[model samples]
Target: MTLAETLQTKLGEWKPAGDGRHSWAETFADSGWAVRIEADRTDTLGCQVWEVALDRVGQADASLTLSAWADRIAASVTGLPEKLKVVEIDQHQSAALLRSDTPGSRGNDVLYFEVRLAGLAKASIRRFKSEHAIGARREQIPFIITHEGLAKVVGDIAG
Candidate 1:
Protein backbone atom coordinates (compact mmCIF):
# COMPACT_ATOMS: atom_id res chain seq x y z
CA MET A 1 0.00 0.00 0.00
CA THR A 2 1.09 3.57 -0.67
CA LEU A 3 1.57 6.08 2.11
CA ALA A 4 -1.74 7.80 1.32
CA GLU A 5 -3.65 4.50 1.35
CA THR A 6 -2.00 3.40 4.56
CA LEU A 7 -2.64 6.78 6.18
CA GLN A 8 -6.31 6.66 5.15
CA THR A 9 -6.63 3.28 6.87
CA LYS A 10 -4.93 4.50 10.01
CA LEU A 11 -6.22 8.11 10.23
CA GLY A 12 -9.84 7.62 9.11
CA GLU A 13 -10.98 10.44 6.79
CA TRP A 14 -8.75 12.67 4.65
CA LYS A 15 -9.73 15.83 2.76
CA PRO A 16 -8.47 16.38 -0.76
CA ALA A 17 -5.67 18.91 -0.79
CA GLY A 18 -6.05 21.45 -3.60
CA ASP A 19 -2.40 22.35 -3.31
CA GLY A 20 -0.39 20.88 -6.15
CA ARG A 21 2.35 19.71 -3.85
CA HIS A 22 0.12 17.44 -1.77
CA SER A 23 -2.54 14.96 -2.91
CA TRP A 24 -4.29 14.66 0.46
CA ALA A 25 -3.98 15.90 4.03
CA GLU A 26 -5.38 15.05 7.48
CA THR A 27 -4.94 16.97 10.70
CA PHE A 28 -5.37 16.24 14.38
CA ALA A 29 -5.62 19.30 16.59
CA ASP A 30 -5.34 19.59 20.36
CA SER A 31 -5.12 22.43 22.85
CA GLY A 32 -1.68 23.62 21.85
CA TRP A 33 -0.60 21.49 18.94
CA ALA A 34 -1.74 20.46 15.50
CA VAL A 35 -0.29 17.49 13.67
CA ARG A 36 -0.78 17.20 9.93
CA ILE A 37 -0.10 14.13 7.83
CA GLU A 38 0.26 14.92 4.19
CA ALA A 39 0.70 12.73 1.13
CA ASP A 40 3.60 14.62 -0.40
CA ARG A 41 3.82 14.15 -4.16
CA THR A 42 6.41 16.79 -4.84
CA ASP A 43 9.13 14.16 -5.08
CA THR A 44 7.56 11.56 -7.40
CA LEU A 45 4.40 9.74 -8.41
CA GLY A 46 5.62 6.17 -7.83
CA CYS A 47 5.22 6.79 -4.09
CA GLN A 48 3.98 9.53 -1.80
CA VAL A 49 6.24 10.38 1.10
CA TRP A 50 4.47 10.57 4.46
CA GLU A 51 5.10 14.09 5.73
CA VAL A 52 4.08 14.80 9.33
CA ALA A 53 4.33 18.38 10.46
CA LEU A 54 3.80 19.38 14.09
CA ASP A 55 2.71 22.97 14.56
CA ARG A 56 2.81 24.59 17.97
CA VAL A 57 -0.31 26.62 18.69
CA GLY A 58 1.41 28.83 21.25
CA GLN A 59 4.80 30.22 22.16
CA ALA A 60 7.58 27.58 22.19
CA ASP A 61 10.88 27.69 24.05
CA ALA A 62 13.14 28.48 21.15
CA SER A 63 16.22 28.59 23.38
CA LEU A 64 16.56 24.83 23.67
CA THR A 65 19.36 23.30 21.60
CA LEU A 66 18.38 21.07 18.71
CA SER A 67 20.20 18.10 20.22
CA ALA A 68 18.45 18.66 23.52
CA TRP A 69 15.08 18.61 21.75
CA ALA A 70 16.06 15.44 19.91
CA ASP A 71 17.08 13.74 23.16
CA ARG A 72 13.87 14.81 24.89
CA ILE A 73 11.84 13.50 21.96
CA ALA A 74 13.73 10.20 21.83
CA ALA A 75 13.33 9.72 25.56
CA SER A 76 9.61 10.41 25.46
CA VAL A 77 8.69 8.44 22.35
CA THR A 78 8.94 4.86 23.59
CA GLY A 79 8.07 3.40 20.19
CA LEU A 80 11.49 4.43 18.85
CA PRO A 81 14.35 1.95 18.71
CA GLU A 82 16.28 1.45 21.94
CA LYS A 83 19.58 2.75 20.57
CA LEU A 84 19.15 5.67 18.21
CA LYS A 85 22.43 6.97 16.89
CA VAL A 86 22.69 10.49 15.64
CA VAL A 87 23.76 10.47 12.00
CA GLU A 88 23.33 14.24 11.60
CA ILE A 89 22.91 17.22 13.88
CA ASP A 90 23.19 20.98 13.68
CA GLN A 91 21.73 24.16 15.16
CA HIS A 92 18.33 23.88 13.47
CA GLN A 93 17.78 20.11 13.44
CA SER A 94 18.88 16.65 14.63
CA ALA A 95 18.46 13.49 12.61
CA ALA A 96 18.86 9.75 13.05
CA LEU A 97 19.08 7.34 10.16
CA LEU A 98 17.85 4.13 11.85
CA ARG A 99 20.04 1.43 10.34
CA SER A 100 20.74 -1.97 11.81
CA ASP A 101 24.21 -2.89 13.07
CA THR A 102 24.28 -5.67 10.51
CA PRO A 103 24.95 -4.79 6.84
CA GLY A 104 22.16 -6.88 5.24
CA SER A 105 19.40 -5.12 7.20
CA ARG A 106 20.54 -1.80 5.80
CA GLY A 107 19.58 0.13 2.60
CA ASN A 108 15.88 0.44 1.77
CA ASP A 109 14.74 -0.85 5.16
CA VAL A 110 16.48 1.99 6.98
CA LEU A 111 14.15 4.59 8.50
CA TYR A 112 15.08 8.26 8.64
CA PHE A 113 13.86 10.52 11.44
CA GLU A 114 14.38 14.21 12.02
CA VAL A 115 13.32 16.94 14.44
CA ARG A 116 13.57 20.39 12.94
CA LEU A 117 12.78 23.57 14.82
CA ALA A 118 12.33 26.81 12.97
CA GLY A 119 9.38 29.03 13.90
CA LEU A 120 7.58 25.75 14.61
CA ALA A 121 8.72 22.25 15.52
CA LYS A 122 8.40 19.59 12.83
CA ALA A 123 9.12 15.91 13.21
CA SER A 124 9.11 13.49 10.31
CA ILE A 125 9.91 9.85 9.49
CA ARG A 126 10.49 8.62 5.95
CA ARG A 127 12.15 5.86 3.90
CA PHE A 128 13.92 5.93 0.56
CA LYS A 129 13.84 3.39 -2.23
CA SER A 130 17.51 3.19 -3.36
CA GLU A 131 19.23 5.02 -0.55
CA HIS A 132 18.40 7.95 1.66
CA ALA A 133 21.78 9.42 0.77
CA ILE A 134 20.48 10.14 -2.73
CA GLY A 135 17.25 11.90 -1.67
CA ALA A 136 13.59 11.30 -0.78
CA ARG A 137 13.03 9.39 -4.02
CA ARG A 138 9.86 7.35 -3.59
CA GLU A 139 9.92 3.56 -3.32
CA GLN A 140 7.41 0.82 -4.13
CA ILE A 141 7.19 -0.62 -0.61
CA PRO A 142 4.65 0.44 2.04
CA PHE A 143 5.86 2.46 5.01
CA ILE A 144 7.09 0.46 7.98
CA ILE A 145 6.67 3.65 10.05
CA THR A 146 3.36 3.66 11.94
CA HIS A 147 0.77 6.38 12.65
CA GLU A 148 0.74 5.50 16.37
CA GLY A 149 4.47 6.11 16.49
CA LEU A 150 3.95 9.52 14.87
CA ALA A 151 1.33 10.43 17.49
CA LYS A 152 3.87 9.73 20.20
CA VAL A 153 6.29 12.04 18.47
CA VAL A 154 3.66 14.78 18.35
CA GLY A 155 2.85 14.33 22.02
CA ASP A 156 6.51 14.57 22.96
CA ILE A 157 6.94 17.73 20.95
CA ALA A 158 3.78 19.23 22.39
CA GLY A 159 4.89 18.51 25.93
Candidate 2:
Protein backbone atom coordinates (compact mmCIF):
# COMPACT_ATOMS: atom_id res chain seq x y z
CA MET A 1 0.00 0.00 0.00
CA THR A 2 1.02 3.64 -0.56
CA LEU A 3 2.40 5.69 2.31
CA ALA A 4 -0.69 7.87 2.34
CA GLU A 5 -2.87 4.80 2.35
CA THR A 6 -0.84 3.36 5.20
CA LEU A 7 -1.02 6.58 7.13
CA GLN A 8 -4.72 6.92 6.49
CA THR A 9 -5.24 3.45 7.89
CA LYS A 10 -2.98 4.13 10.86
CA LEU A 11 -4.22 7.61 11.58
CA GLY A 12 -7.84 6.63 11.40
CA GLU A 13 -10.44 9.28 12.28
CA TRP A 14 -7.89 12.05 12.61
CA LYS A 15 -9.11 14.84 10.30
CA PRO A 16 -6.10 15.81 8.26
CA ALA A 17 -5.13 19.45 8.20
CA GLY A 18 -3.27 21.42 5.48
CA ASP A 19 -3.76 20.75 1.73
CA GLY A 20 -5.14 17.30 2.53
CA ARG A 21 -3.27 15.63 -0.30
CA HIS A 22 0.29 16.66 -1.09
CA SER A 23 0.66 18.10 2.40
CA TRP A 24 -1.23 17.30 5.56
CA ALA A 25 -0.91 17.01 9.33
CA GLU A 26 -2.31 15.09 12.27
CA THR A 27 -2.02 15.67 15.99
CA PHE A 28 -1.65 12.77 18.38
CA ALA A 29 -2.40 14.31 21.73
CA ASP A 30 -1.95 11.12 23.69
CA SER A 31 1.50 10.79 22.23
CA GLY A 32 2.33 14.45 22.82
CA TRP A 33 3.45 14.83 19.24
CA ALA A 34 2.09 16.41 16.05
CA VAL A 35 3.10 14.85 12.75
CA ARG A 36 3.09 16.26 9.25
CA ILE A 37 3.79 14.26 6.12
CA GLU A 38 4.36 15.69 2.66
CA ALA A 39 4.43 13.63 -0.53
CA ASP A 40 4.00 16.33 -3.08
CA ARG A 41 6.94 15.44 -5.35
CA THR A 42 9.19 12.71 -6.75
CA ASP A 43 12.89 11.95 -6.71
CA THR A 44 15.34 11.16 -9.49
CA LEU A 45 14.69 7.42 -9.15
CA GLY A 46 11.09 7.98 -10.25
CA CYS A 47 10.06 7.06 -6.74
CA GLN A 48 7.52 9.18 -4.90
CA VAL A 49 9.60 11.24 -2.44
CA TRP A 50 8.23 12.21 0.92
CA GLU A 51 9.04 13.53 4.39
CA VAL A 52 7.65 13.04 7.83
CA ALA A 53 8.08 15.64 10.59
CA LEU A 54 7.21 15.15 14.21
CA ASP A 55 7.14 17.93 16.79
CA ARG A 56 6.62 17.77 20.49
CA VAL A 57 3.79 19.86 21.95
CA GLY A 58 3.11 21.59 25.26
CA GLN A 59 5.62 22.51 27.98
CA ALA A 60 7.95 19.61 27.43
CA ASP A 61 11.57 20.53 26.88
CA ALA A 62 13.18 19.05 23.77
CA SER A 63 16.77 19.45 24.92
CA LEU A 64 19.05 16.44 24.72
CA THR A 65 22.68 15.39 24.88
CA LEU A 66 23.95 15.64 21.31
CA SER A 67 25.33 12.12 21.11
CA ALA A 68 22.28 10.57 22.75
CA TRP A 69 19.55 11.92 20.46
CA ALA A 70 21.76 11.47 17.45
CA ASP A 71 22.32 7.82 18.25
CA ARG A 72 18.68 7.27 19.07
CA ILE A 73 17.35 8.57 15.76
CA ALA A 74 20.07 6.84 13.79
CA ALA A 75 19.49 3.52 15.47
CA SER A 76 15.73 3.84 15.15
CA VAL A 77 15.98 3.99 11.36
CA THR A 78 18.39 1.17 10.74
CA GLY A 79 19.53 -2.13 12.16
CA LEU A 80 22.74 -3.94 13.12
CA PRO A 81 26.13 -2.59 12.00
CA GLU A 82 24.86 -1.00 8.78
CA LYS A 83 23.48 2.27 10.06
CA LEU A 84 22.96 5.89 9.06
CA LYS A 85 26.27 7.67 9.02
CA VAL A 86 26.83 11.07 10.52
CA VAL A 87 27.39 13.75 7.91
CA GLU A 88 27.52 16.94 9.96
CA ILE A 89 26.42 18.54 13.16
CA ASP A 90 26.08 22.10 14.40
CA GLN A 91 25.69 22.58 18.11
CA HIS A 92 25.00 25.70 20.09
CA GLN A 93 23.92 26.48 23.62
CA SER A 94 20.27 26.69 22.65
CA ALA A 95 19.97 24.93 19.32
CA ALA A 96 21.52 22.11 17.33
CA LEU A 97 21.31 20.36 13.97
CA LEU A 98 22.35 16.84 13.07
CA ARG A 99 22.47 15.54 9.50
CA SER A 100 23.09 11.94 8.52
CA ASP A 101 25.08 10.86 5.48
CA THR A 102 23.13 10.72 2.24
CA PRO A 103 22.48 7.63 0.19
CA GLY A 104 24.14 7.09 -3.19
CA SER A 105 22.59 8.95 -6.11
CA ARG A 106 23.03 9.39 -9.86
CA GLY A 107 23.22 13.16 -9.60
CA ASN A 108 24.56 15.70 -7.13
CA ASP A 109 21.12 15.95 -5.61
CA VAL A 110 20.74 13.56 -2.71
CA LEU A 111 18.53 13.46 0.32
CA TYR A 112 19.42 12.81 3.96
CA PHE A 113 17.69 12.65 7.27
CA GLU A 114 18.05 15.45 9.82
CA VAL A 115 17.28 16.20 13.43
CA ARG A 116 16.84 19.65 14.95
CA LEU A 117 16.66 20.70 18.56
CA ALA A 118 15.80 24.34 19.04
CA GLY A 119 15.71 26.94 21.82
CA LEU A 120 11.94 26.92 22.10
CA ALA A 121 12.17 23.30 23.21
CA LYS A 122 11.01 22.02 19.85
CA ALA A 123 12.43 19.00 18.09
CA SER A 124 11.99 18.12 14.42
CA ILE A 125 12.69 14.98 12.41
CA ARG A 126 12.93 15.22 8.63
CA ARG A 127 13.80 13.05 5.68
CA PHE A 128 14.95 15.25 2.84
CA LYS A 129 14.32 14.46 -0.84
CA SER A 130 15.99 15.73 -3.97
CA GLU A 131 13.23 16.33 -6.49
CA HIS A 132 13.58 16.01 -10.25
CA ALA A 133 11.38 18.20 -12.42
CA ILE A 134 11.72 15.86 -15.43
CA GLY A 135 11.60 12.13 -16.16
CA ALA A 136 9.35 9.32 -15.02
CA ARG A 137 8.99 8.58 -11.31
CA ARG A 138 7.84 5.35 -9.71
CA GLU A 139 4.58 5.07 -7.84
CA GLN A 140 5.70 2.39 -5.39
CA ILE A 141 7.26 4.35 -2.53
CA PRO A 142 10.19 3.36 -0.33
CA PHE A 143 10.63 3.52 3.44
CA ILE A 144 8.34 1.37 5.48
CA ILE A 145 8.24 2.70 9.04
CA THR A 146 6.26 0.86 11.62
CA HIS A 147 4.06 2.71 14.10
CA GLU A 148 5.91 0.92 16.91
CA GLY A 149 9.20 2.31 15.64
CA LEU A 150 7.69 5.79 15.65
CA ALA A 151 6.45 5.44 19.19
CA LYS A 152 9.84 4.27 20.41
CA VAL A 153 11.65 7.19 18.78
CA VAL A 154 9.10 9.72 19.95
CA GLY A 155 9.18 8.26 23.41
CA ASP A 156 12.92 8.74 23.51
CA ILE A 157 12.54 12.36 22.43
CA ALA A 158 9.81 13.06 24.93
CA GLY A 159 11.79 11.62 27.76
Candidate with the greatest lDDT versus the true structure? 2
Residue 17 miss distance in model 2 (angstroms): 13
lDDT of each: 0.45, 0.49
* TM per prediction: 0.51, 0.50
Give the worst 10-residue stretch by lDDT in candidate 1: 96-105
For 1-159, candidate 2 gives per-residue lDDT tens digits of: 433334445543333344423655766666566666554432222212255566666555446455565555565644211235444445656555655555434374444556676643566655554544455332322343444444344455444
Tens-digit lDDT track of model 1 for 20-112: 445444343334455565554322122243555666555557686556665565556554433333444554443433222222225454443
| Residue-level lDDT for 19 in candidate 2 | 44
